[model samples]
Target: YINDVCRTLREEMKRAGIHAEVHAWQKHLASISRKLEYVPRQSNENPLSQLHDLVSFRILVDTDNECYLALGHIHALWRPKDGRIKDFIATPKLNGYQSLHTTVFCLHDCLAEIQIRTHDMQRTATYGIASFWYLKDRMGKEGSPNSWKLSYKEMVTWIEQLRQWQQELPESADEFVEAFKGDVFQDQIFVFTPKGEVKDLPRGSTPLDMAYRIHTDLGDHCAGARIITNMDESGCLVTRQVPLDYELKGGEIVALLTNPAVHPTRDWLHFARTNAARNKIRRYLKTYERESQQADASAPVPGCQTTTMTIHAQDRPGLFRDLTAIFADGGINIGSVSSTVQERSRAIISLSFHLPPSLKETLRALLHQIQALHEIEHVALEPHDDTF
Candidate 1:
């Protein structure tokens, strides 16, 4: 079985343009006895530690995007068995290992497991146990102790959860083991932020999972979800509504809106299949629950304040960052900001920040900086009232 499997794998590797070599070891008891006066033939047999018929294939790629492209090529070439595609790059393994895996039938009804990962991912997987040792060897320096603290914390949490599960359901150890294997190692979904940051989530993630992916605060405060893509007459995406919960495919973008009044429910925990999403919801609920218990904790009564400034510049990178940095440096908090991009390659940024006592001078200096950028056609300030 091993020889046949190895031969099929080698063929596949060549077809996929990967370079690899396989080696097998064997020993004969008769040969060993004849070679020496005292010959010992030892065979280590441990059923629990027995090696499985898993074949790991490493593929090198130029970039993260190329990694997904390789996955597509491999899947298209092989018929993956149902529920056999696992993408850890999107969700990653518990120890922060990332890869793409699939099981397929190769040569005469024989099933083979294939693991795909980039060169860097392979190094991380092999040396992650002695991560600090590798890092010191590479950089000739030691990193801060705090670098490993998060890993330690995650380990402790896993241990505590395991103990709790054992205590709560002592008779279901086998069931727990099976479920743990299924849950702890699984494929990931790739979702996007409104600004296009990729978020790798566990399979079966919802828009709520997306919200938490942005930030815990955003997730807890998520009131509702809005799928940003257009729908057809049947309401299914000509491109599909990025599936919520099931394994998320690569190249899906999502956005989330939040309201402070929203709170998570126990049902959310049930529906939230990912540990990250569930833990975030629980944390948010606990925090808000405590806040509610301590004080009035009512949503801040809606109120409004307003100011207006005219921005004159060609839209450029870091323009918003630069403008906001000025206000932030001056300790002027923004109430709102809006901008209009014109066809003539000009833009007007209108900002509504807390009115400072020295408003005129601040406005003048900001306008001067904007004008100094050499892109401003003109600048103006308008009087505005505190009404939303």
Candidate 2:
């Protein structure tokens, strides 16, 4: 069975475009004493049949994404036993173990347990996080990417939660367990983009939430979801438009549609399912809000030919340099410049500039030049009513 599983895994890896040398494959049989000791305690009607993990197989890869790819390949190859699939990667155990586990019917219709995890996860599972940290130190990769550091942080968070629970002192064990279920444990679903990349979202996440997860612009201009069905011979997708409020069931392939004319409305608050999404919508709405108290904060300067303009752009280094360079080329002096950066990494720059008679006549042309600068999204004269 070991030989058969190994050969099959190699073949599947090849089919999945995973080269031979990078991944690790291992198999083991439970020791007799351990199996004997485990069975009697469970008191199964038939101990022999109850032990599904007697023969265990492991496929260790490099990254969390590859773990899911391996899982897809394995499930495609074999029929998994009913109710045997467990996704520990999305929700790591209190001990920081992460894996994708499933029991499959292998050769001769015999049951075998398969565990898929990243190599780092396999190390943590085998020798705990300290050993992983030590191995990383030996390799001089302690600070590179530092994926294990995230696990360490999660461990610390769990310890802190435990301490908080102790201080709070739950009235009973049942209450403590309930608190754990409500706080520490969360229900999440995995969905795929039209391009097949998986995204883990909370159980009740809507398509609007998913759109925001993909990008702030995608969410800001989101029209609705286009549920991808399949591609035709011409390579165009056949998709059904779903409402932004539509709740997701795991495994749905979704494509968010956008309209440049569409923008967030107060109605969106009722549909948004994630705090990130809801907050982005609120920020966008407030930016163009007509009733905003600060709407006239940049009221026309007295005795000066000035124009108040607000430029919306993506936040990045050297962006101000490019913007200022454009105005300098136009030979215009900025009377005043202030910026408000939003939580979603968007920058709104309000610039008050002396509108010379020549510049005023060619204001549209000058604004066009500023708009052409990379990273700049919209350049609108302030105190104007405009949607996103």
- For model 1 the local lDDT of residue 227 reads 49
Best by TM-score: 2
- Residue 21's lDDT within candidate 2 is 30
Task: For candidate 2, write residues 106-164 as lDDT tens digits.
Answer: 77777888888776777889898788668767765545456666555644655665565
| TM-scores, each model vs. reference | 0.36, 0.47
Residue 90 lDDT in candidate 1: 53
Query: Candidate 2 at residue 307, lDDT?
Result: 70
* Model 1, span 256-308: residue lDDT tens: 65667876876677656655566556656778678876543222223422456
The per-prediction CA RMSD against the true structure, in angstroms, equals 20.4, 17.8
Quote the positional error of residue 133 for candidate 2 in Å: 1.2
Best by lDDT: 2
* Stretches > 4 Å off in candidate 2: 1-10, 17-57, 62-65, 75-96, 100-114, 141-185, 228-239, 288-388
In angstroms, the error of model 1 at 30 is 21
* Candidate 1 vs. true structure, TM-score: 0.36
